[model samples]
Target: MKKKVLFYLGILIAWFPAFSQTDNSVSAITEAREQLVRKNHEKSYVSHILTGKRYDLKYRGAVNSQFFRDIYPSYGTLVYDGVFFDHIEIQLDIYQEKVVVLLESKNNEQFVTIDNEKVSELTFNNYKFVHIRHDSIMSDGLYQHAFQGKHSDTFIKRTKLKKDKIENTKMIIEFVPLDKYYIKNDWGTFAITNKKSFLKAFQNSEAVVSIVKKNKTKFSKKKIENGLLKAVSLLDPLLIDN
Candidate 1:
């Protein structure tokens, strides 16, 4: 009787490893299926479409108005919460000063406004925009992304809707406003009031002063975007090092 019992015990021990291996395989397959379902759900649910808001102007790809860049509704990529989404259509709503994206919905396509705070950076058409803390006399600590160097020295082309009356007919005109450049200094941020005031602002930086004096022709008028950008480029390194 004792010999028979020992023989059965040996058989049970040999079967244990096979049973454990089979259970592990089953668990792995179940976990993989669950992950796939979650991924699909995120793809369908994590979308935003604009409705009932007058803030975003419809981007009709018309050349009637001035924009941040010439390209409208161009293919672009956006980064949010450190995740990247590509093959998306984007446009700059200058009137609203926000980056708008076109998203696909079951019924139709809709416009979605991206949250500035969640957006780390955006690349649209040929421009790269990054959020920065801007301080200026007109606005204070306003958070927005312009061209990369725009924070250091800002250049903007803005448009305002104006009414034009001719022969008792009132027509809306896309009025292009005067361009201006604002520079940030240790003292504070302010627009270039005049040639002499700008020179005084950068008076400490001899290199910038010399550049401005050399290209005095450009600063003859109120707006000198290219020259102003060049001056900021030269002084940026010094600002960073300090």
Candidate 2:
């Protein structure tokens, strides 16, 4: 059965010719794009879709968010094994590191999970995330692209966890957010949690710390994002020779 599906997908994927502005060429390209979309749909669904087991929501828990942005499946795009697919219903499970999708078969519907290792890029919530693996400085995981500079780039690792606590004389599980920020340069990737850590990433820590204070940049967890972006822009020129 799997072989049959793979063979079916192979025949549908075809090469495109060089595009021209003529009316006939434009029409041909449109048809080809439509075909490509259809092929992508079939290839993505038929080959990689998995009937993933979902956690029971009946457990006593007051959850805030267990997903990337929305608790429900959001329309997005993903690059799976070098194939680009758009208009896919997906949810990024921050806790379990899973990608769940809603798949409909006839009159029935199910939330299915896809292989995460095959997925390199995912877009939703007006943001882009890339799966980083086999890197020298960074750990293997999904990281959200925050800012890019000539000397360095920044990424965010998003996560959540369920904590058991007592509230109103009842035991309840609450979801908590835990996010980590990283800065990667030619040397290595460093986790910058606060001003101290941010300054530590540079060779001249004392000078960098003074410059950061002079510019009044707060780089703690509360204001890490904007702070890091501003710091990168401020320091990129100084490290241009490095």
Candidate 3:
């Protein structure tokens, strides 16, 4: 009886640590999922940038009926022609109710139009900006600018990773060029050389995990401004042209 009692006690002690670890892992995964959902909601705001703009913009949400029917017909090729602007073709991918903006370029012999079949090949070239949660455990800029704007350039591009969960998860935000000159001149080149910016942005933008938990559901203008500034500052070294 004494030996059996000791053996059971040892098993209980071993199982306790395993149970605790499993609980911790589950909590971490749950928190990560919540952070991701918040990030997705925050990204929805990017659409506001195109609210009244004449540029062609598309939206795909997580609905199947009308959304799928509406997007499927345009799957082959989409051409946009504005009186003051040259023609442009946008290749789109509609899956899981998320629309990835594939490519945009001038309709010319030098540029190649994207086809629906080639979307997977072109997705890597596409850029997206998102807001993310971060933990305050470390200090570094969370964003970077790949291209420096010219003197007269009206817009600039920046990319950043907002850290969340002690660097375990990150929200990658890519500032898109709203201005025509910046879009045409700087976008392509920066996309190629600015890979480091992505890493650095994640490093710089650490915040308190508790703060993120408190503010996850609420959107604050101040937080967005601060994050944007930090991201742009990381790009200072690359901003020589501006």
Q: Each candidate: what lDDT?
A: 0.56, 0.75, 0.30
The runs of at least 3 residues in candidate 3 whose Cα sits more than 4 Å from the true structure, single-residue gaps closed, are 1-85, 89-91, 94-230, 233-242
Q: Tell me which of candidates 1 and 2 scores higher on TM-score.
A: 2
Best by TM-score: 2
Q: Give lDDT tens digits, candidate 3, residues 1-242.
A: 45655565565556555555687865755565566556665665432211111323322332222222233322232212211111222222222212233333366222222222222211112322111124132112111122333411112223222222323474332222221111112222111113233223333233322233444422233343343334444444344342
Candidate ranking under lDDT, highest first, comes to: 2, 1, 3
Clashing pairs in 1: none
lDDT of 1 by residue, 1-242 (tens): 44544564465556556555787765655565566555665765655433322235543433355355554588888776566778788766554556677877788777777665666666776666554444345442122233334226553433334334344563444534444456656555656646566666665567667766776636546456556666666665555433
Model 1: CA > 4 A from native:
1-63, 81-83, 105-107, 134-170, 178-180, 185-188, 220-222, 235-240
Candidate 3 TM-score, C-alpha based: 0.18
Q: What range of 10 consecutive residues in model 3 has the weakest lDDT sum?
A: 175-184
> In model 2, what lDDT does residue 97 have?
80
Residue 57 alpha-carbon offset, candidate 3, angstroms: 15
